[model samples]
Target: MKITVMTADEQFITLDVDPEESVENVKALLEVETRVSLQQQQLLFNGKEMRNAERLSSVGVRDNDLVMMVLHTSAPSSRAPTNDLSFHPDGSAINPGAFQQHVRRDSDMMAQLLQRDPALAQAILGSDLNGLQNLLRERHQQRLELRRQQEEEMALMYADPFDVESQKKIEAAIRQKGIDENWAAALEYNPEAFARVIMLYVDMEVNGVPLKAFVDSGAQSTIISKSCAERCGLLRLLDQRYKGIAHGVGQTEILGRIHVAPIKIGNIFYPCSFMVLDAPNMEFLFGLDMLRKHQCIIDLKENVLRVGGGEVSVPFLQEKDIPTHFLDESRYSKQGSLGPGSLPESSGAKEKNDNMPTGSRSSGTTLSDPTRGPEFEAKIAKLVDLGFGREAVIQALSLFNGNEEQAAGFLFGG
Candidate 1:
């Protein structure tokens, strides 16, 4: 019977074979024709895989049927027979143990035997035992060389005081490694230690109540603790069905989201949305989505979170007013000029102070102030004319402290 065989690379070949022949016979012929070993040939018929022991007629294979063949390069196992051991070089019966010992001790005899049969040489080279030993030795040498180079480079990076960029790179790498190791160790030993470490927390207001929120750039969606949401009356704003599941470190929970929840950071307000989850003893988490939308910048080294970087200096809460709640007491002691008590409450509340001069207070009046209704409306209209959503423009205006220039900066920052 004649059949057509198609290869994975879209090559085709026509072959004539007996209908009663086993699939192994077809594989042997394919190996001779295509140089693909019988063990590496994967045959498929009618979209189903074919086994070597299966007979062509038993599998419903008919004349002119099409079969697909895929070739792989996996080495044969060590225990697999590579060559016939029935005859010796002197045409005598070969003993397996004596042959192995002779091949091990007599390199000249091994070479002469391999030279006589090229197939045996090819089989030995393609065996897993030879390949695995070479691969393992190469990997070990590469790793040792890599480790030595890293040690030398690190020594130079630390010894050379003038190489600032290298020093910075090394320090950043070490810091990231330390953070990963410490976080893993903490999770293993004291899972609750995460709550006490508040290096990324920022003071903000939900609705009108003061609250602390964590800035998590890695998170895809902003999250509000259920307790915090309840306290701020944000639970009442939940309009969407709580069908989504949130995955965390060691837990997964159903989450409810509140759209357009008013959040105030410093003196600016942002109409942000948050997924509400039942996180105990933890504050709100502002994710990358909200941070990117607001063009927020977190500068840990300077210890200041700045928004709207250019000419129009937006209203910002003094660093002193922001609290440091890190578990590491050393950070508390290292708090330089930006301590909580450094700025007077009156100075920090300059825009809201009732005792300020009339001219000064009028100049500081923002869109958030109820007295600037007409001006706020005009600013919103102008921003909407610039192709921004009314709600988004209003939020941006509040986030920029009512400064039209700063609001425009925020919108176009991306």
Candidate 2:
């Protein structure tokens, strides 16, 4: 018989199972299919919780029946309020029906109260109204004290900027911090600074297998997830003594380097080296090392990744077309830029340059030009908001000599 399983995220999967199979056995099958552990799965059938020892037939499960599975970090609480009550504080008998109705009216509040006081959970289930009332009062008092302490801490942190002692303490704390402190400070003071650039991704092939790759200019070296390498059968054990560490925002990890790894994008095939990291969340990253070597240009305006100076360009997959697992939706926007500088201007810019005398333009071009100043940052941010990565947008603008229309065209493949 086939059973349809639905997850909390609304993902559905169909499984064939024996009539005598237990709920735990079904969970084992789900673990293999979904990569979710059995312990985290809470299976429900017909609005009733399914026990590990319960048989499918015993639970009256039919073919193609839908079973709901909720994933949680911990087991769900089984406590529930009953239609019974205890004596009140004044030695008066509480009305069982009224107390039960109150608990039923705000089930979420009662659940929170039970979570804060596990000892009171049994009292609630057993209808010990007086015990539950006392427990709730104590929990409320604890929350009040916690909130007061948090408020005091916030007040001290935001004390008068002109207060020398407080400012000195703040400076000292910042000085003692690591790289994450700077990121936090930037997030707090200059959110737009980081928001100007967004992550870019493209579809590429590795050993004839389609793979999604993140385009990151800031990464010193190309990196591939160990899982991807292994899945592609490209992972070869390196010398044990050649271990190295890779540092990124807020974290660092040891990596195993692989050389001469071939990656194919469109018609071009490039043999590059990559540092293999155990990055499960991100499978592939095409870093500066590969981009520079290929003279690759990511045209956000054209919506393509050009190789060999536009000799060959592959259009990127639309956000919706890309696999849900491959992209981090939270970090990207859906809006796209259509205005000037949002298209490619390769032809126009080249024509203008050809008309000008050689060496007429300044020889000095700084790496920071595309990303510098409020106007440039604003343009990049706007393009990013339109669903393009900041680096790709900046690169397109630079390629077109800051022509917004050309960059935008380039991104949209216009």
Candidate 3:
């Protein structure tokens, strides 16, 4: 059989060998071909780590499979076999237990990094961080830009209160898609910005108590730290032991039980899966498998993850609505003066006011008002409630095409 190996350095090594070769033979061949020590490197097929003990059966090794080699550069691995350690027995002979101890130490470190950040570990195991970091950073930037585009798309998706005819035009456009007003509205987020993306946040629960997580989509798998698992009251149910080594990190033992909680994001709820990692640096990580189901809109260019069924507008600073110069002085200081930083008191006062707690802000508004039900008597009450500016309510309802439940999700993503 002919085997091709892809190194982390973007190099490829093709070897003609027997199909019965053990994975250890491939590693040794790779070490000889690439000058990377088998004990100091890990190999992967596709995206998963490949063990040296695996045999290259026809199903396991085939042509065109992406075989990657990751070289170990830093960090002491307790998993890899090393002969650096020795202990003198009472007879002054070298004890092999020292080598065992080294292997044990490396195993522990590899476990830790895997549990803490499997994706990062995957990168390290690939013997490449630069490529992975660049990829993630690019993804993040795209998310930010996506948010900006969403802001620009709001007028196009929703009928503006001030633009009645424009509103009708949008309704007409979506109506042509064979969609009802409600369904259209539910999916009416800016396609260029909020379409075809799934964004999620981590919600950890300890005995059913919710915990907030700032999710990083770049992460590969869920990693819950030991302390967090303890706090969440997770008792160790089993040991998911993995033995491999990554560069510049330690190993870990992942021990925790699965806990489910409602993850609410912009009118979306996901009951999720979690794994406990023993890293002190990590709180929790949400992986990619769960995100593929929902319709997610991520503005990678905007640095914001809009979870589901709503527009997440990324704020940008622009010059607009500046107060006209208050040439009237003592009588009219409210007219505003100076440039971005011309007035010291104005800036300080502005900062002080900004620092104060905001009363409350919801991501959305109610369809009518909560106090008013669907009854005729609630009509007047509804109108009264709409007085908080019925236009806003209309806009929010328009967001859901009138599905108040979803609209509430977008509006009150509290």
> Which candidate number has the best TM-score?
2
lDDT agreement with native, every candidate = 0.56, 0.60, 0.44
| Model 1 vs. true fold: TM | 0.30
**Model 2 score (lDDT):** 0.60
Off by over 4 Å in 3: 1-212, 236-248, 256-261, 266-268, 301-303, 309-414
Best by lDDT: 2
* Off by more than 4 A, model 1: 1-198, 309-414
Candidates ranked by TM-score: 2, 1, 3
Using alpha carbons, what is the TM-score of model 3? Answer: 0.23
Give the per-residue lDDT of model 1 (tens digit) for 1-414: 889787666655566777877787787556434435567788899888888788999998999999999875675633324342233333222334432442334344345436544543333345444443344345345544655665655575666667887778677768767977975786689655323223356677888988866666655557777788889988888744543333221122434568787887777777898866655534476776787788778776666566544212223334344443422222222331111111111112112224334453313212123114789799999879768888666655553335676566556542
- Kindly give the number of clashing pairs for every candidate: 0, 32, 35
Model 3 residue 73 CA deviation (Å) reads 65
Per-model TM-score versus the true fold: 0.30, 0.34, 0.23
Q: Could you give candidate 2's per-residue lDDT for residues 46-118 as a string of tens digits?
A: 9998998999999989998999999867754332222133334432224544544544444543554455445
RMSD of candidates 1 onward, in order: 26.0, 22.8, 30.1
Candidate 3 C-alpha lDDT tens digits along 214-296: 34433333445667666766545323332111111112444543655444443445666565554443455544434444444
